[model samples]
Target: MTAVTLTADRRRGLQRRIRWIVTATIAYNVLEAVVAITAGSIASSGALIAFGLDSTIEVLSAAAVAWQFTRRDPERWEKPTLRVIAIAFFALAVYVIATSLLALIGRVEAEHSTLGIIVTAMSVVIMPFLSLAERRTGRELGSATAVADSKQTLICTCLSAAVLAGLLLNSLLGWWWADAVAGLVIAGFAVREGIEAWRGDACATSVGMILEGDDHGI
Candidate 1:
């Protein structure tokens, strides 16, 4: 095959792989959200509930990315899909902030959530690498949809870390308010990312974009 043909084939392969990975991640997140919410409700852990909501929003973002990827003309749909993803993130942030504030004002204490901590720890360990890999691959392929998906993964990594920290502090230090405080941090990050994504600015200058000669990669 010619070099052009080889590059096209490689791009197709990468797209397929990214689609599979994102789909799998979304599926797992859906299950995790359900489990986390159930456990959080029983344990009365606000952090766990916020983590579950974050995962649920991630599932929506992943689905949006998948739709963008499979479109016949992704460029035409990119901006709209990204806006929708951004709105989803914004909604999640609003929910987190409201709930966290209520918990803080009421002095509601989170109960022990061993399961929540374990799941969040697992996500913290796995998600950053997945996001970085996807970001690099998306940049190489000049795929905005994939880059957006990578941002969602990065958000997941951050949320997991915050959730884990909140759970740990609450569990070990008996700082009952730590979980709600962490929820506020997560909400702040989510709102920032949501605004960026809504403005079509996510991955504005990602490493992949620099390599691909596109400043507005996502």
Candidate 2:
């Protein structure tokens, strides 16, 4: 009984930490979206605009995670939360692909965007830490929603790197098409992750038997 009590306490502590991390993610993404969209519009850079939209999707994913944990039965919220995240991912992919295709075919030129560069660089630095923390805690807690959210964060990190590289190449090498290419790569990644999240295979369900009744639903 004592061991069981201690284990439950630890789980509660971890869940609280995961909640805090998701909250921080949502806050940062909100700021990032505003800054990136503003800077992208100013620079007329499609890649930067897409990056900003990706931040919005990140906000949605994090919000879903937050909503799940706030429920009386967090496990019961898992399927819906995953569906929301998957939809966000698919939306991200569609937007990015469309933007990239337009930029590529139209021969659209992207101007140097120092602000976009700075914001994406910061995201690349910050998101990894958030992802690692949540992933570790979520796995320990047997919370698939938390782990899925962490994956979403990690995907954003990858998008950050792609967007940063594109901005740097355009600014330094005058490779205007680099941004479009990077957007395509980001689209591919988003699609893959979206499938995984939709399948609810973002993490194993071996712990806690939480997924035993997953298909039947509450």
Candidate 3:
């Protein structure tokens, strides 16, 4: 095959991989949200509930990217899709911060949650592999949306670790406050990712336009 054909084939492969990655992300997050929320309700654990809500936001973010890729001209849809992802991140930050503060002030002591530990532990193992796969493909494809989605997945991994730590600490040492602290950390990461996504949209949009114009001139 010619070099052009090889490049085209590689791009197709990348697109396929991205699709699979985001679809898996959506499926896992949906399952996670349902299970985490259910477990939290049963245990009266604020942290697990907040983690579940974050998983829901992850679903939205991944869905936006999935929709973007479905378009014939995905670049045209980039800005709005990125806005959706950014808004999801901001929503996550706001909720996590507010809930963490309430949990701290109310001296909320979360009951031990065996299910929470198991689910979060599974996420901790699963998410990093998904994020890394998507990240590598995104970089090769020069797809900011895909990269942003991967970052969101990475953050979910962080949250998994946080919730796991919280559950473990509370179970082992009766340190119910650990989860609240972890929630604050999650909030900070969410805000940072949101700002980065919004800023990246502007830069990537400009670059995409330039590349498209060049192709037209060719």
Candidate 4:
């Protein structure tokens, strides 16, 4: 972070990297939403449905960052773009918490969904890599919006893991409550991230000071 300064040429390269990374993220989440929603509907799994909805929000958040990076002066739009990503995180937190609570109250026992299991498992493997790439690029470029979006992606990875664990528990045993509980936990994570994004749009010494920081080496 300290060593690599974002000169004009380096800035362009990092922006391009962010675009490509977000594009791939968008594509994968679109497919994930379709599969998870379909599988959740068939299996009557509220957690899976919430997961799908979260994917759709991820698409929107990533799309915001993608759009921001396309701006002629991307750094100029950092605050607003990060606000958008933060709102998305808050929205996801609210929705997941509601769904999880309802599922718990109803004691909803969903049918075994091989599709749900497979899709969530796939996300668990795929999402962290994308998140890490975007985060590193964002930090180097001093782009708050891009970094916020990466955290959102990381949250999705956590959600994927929670859902996968819940599905496995339900499938192997009869612990249908597992996914709902996990969703509640992930919702808390989302809220915490949302707060970070909201207050952190203007990172101390990072904004407008590309690649001039400590060598924490993130």
Candidate 5:
């Protein structure tokens, strides 16, 4: 095959892989959100609640990617699709910050959550590799949407780490406030990432797309 043909084939394969990953991530996030919420409520763990909200945001981001991929013309859809995802991220950040603040003011103390800790540990183990693979494929294919989705996965990995640490400290040290503190930290990181995604900084790799052209016509 010619170089152009090879590139085209690679793009197709990457897109297919991304689609599958997005679908699985969405499904997993939905289940994760439900479980996180239930576990958080039972344990009164702020970190778990924040983690659940973050998963919900990931679901929204995945939906946006699915929509973008389905478009007949991805280039034409790119800017507007990214804008939609950004808006969703911004809104989620606002909600998370507001609720976290309210909880802090109310002096809420979190209980021990074995289930939340277990789930968070699992996410920490799983998400980083998946995100790195998606990001590598996205760089090869020059798919901004896929890259943005990968960033979301990266954020989830970070959030899982923070949640696990907070839960562990609170459970073992009797530091009831650590979970709420962790939620604040997670919210800060999420807000920063959300703003970056909303402003298009996260998906600004159009240079690759430009070089490759479209439909293997390079």
Candidate 6:
């Protein structure tokens, strides 16, 4: 892929844009976590609880990227920030796997949660826009951390869909197992993305690596 040469002003602008995107993502996920966790506890829906925890993990990932951008030389912080994001993904996978297993072993029946459904539905609509915007900006800026964080946001969108489906199935057809199924599905995706981020492949986005001066080599 060809590198899109960015002027100094544009680079700074993109960095600022990333900070804004992560901040917005963090804010929305915070509200989502609170509402979903509360609703999940009331409804005894493990999927909803897992969804809330995922939101918290998304917050952590976005925060890492935001912190990376705050540095005077954001590129220097890229690898560590990406690793932080990777660890967050793994943490989410472990939690969801354990929750799904416990829910299955215990034969836990998930009650319907109207709030959980609503919040997840909202996320399904909101997260994609944020992910796309950040991804485009990241690609142009050649920011690995930004791109990885965008992927993290995209994962939230998928999880929102899965959790929403599970809630609907349980509510409409008494498919209590759907909740556990959704949790397991999310865990699988999380582990895959975690491995990619840890291996630094997430930075293989089309930006062709960031450069402050004229040096550019992959």
Estimate every model's Cα lDDT from 0 to 1.
0.75, 0.83, 0.82, 0.88, 0.72, 0.85
Candidate 5 or 4, higher TM-score: 4
Worst 10 residues of 5 by lDDT: 209-218
Considering summed lDDT, which 10 consecutive residues are worst modelled in model 2? 209-218
Give one digit per residue, the lDDT tens place, for model 4 in 36-84.
9999999988888989999999999999999998999998888888889
Off-target runs (Cα >4 Å) in candidate 3 are 1-6, 201-218
| Candidate 2 RMSD to the correct structure | 5.6
Q: Per-residue alpha-carbon lDDT of model 3 for 1-218, expressed as tens digits?
A: 11111255555666777888899999999999999999999999999999999999999999998888878777677678778888888898899889989999999998888999999999999999999888766655667788888888888899889989989999999898898899899889889988888877523323232222211110
Q: Could you estimate the TM-score for every candidate?
A: 0.86, 0.90, 0.89, 0.93, 0.84, 0.92
Q: Give me the candidate number with maximum TM-score.
A: 4
lDDT string for model 2 (52-165, tens) is: 988999999999998888777777777789889889889988998999899999988878888989999999999999999888777666777788889889988988898898
| Predicted structure with the largest lDDT when compared to the true one | 4
Residue-wise lDDT of candidate 6 within 1-218, one digit each (tens)? 55447767777788898999999999999999999999999988878888898899999999999999899988888789889999998998898889889988898888878899899999999999999989877877888778888988887898899889888988999887786777788789889998988877886653345534324311
Task: Indicate the TM-score of model 3.
Answer: 0.89
Q: By descending lDDT, how would the candidates be arranged?
A: 4, 6, 2, 3, 1, 5
**Total clashing pairs in model 5:** 0
- Model 5 scores a C-alpha lDDT of 0.72
Q: Estimate, for each residue in 35-78, the C-alpha lDDT of model 5 and write its tens digit.
A: 88889999977668878887888898888887777776565666
With a 3 Å backbone cut-off (N, CA, C), the pairs that clash in candidate 1 are none
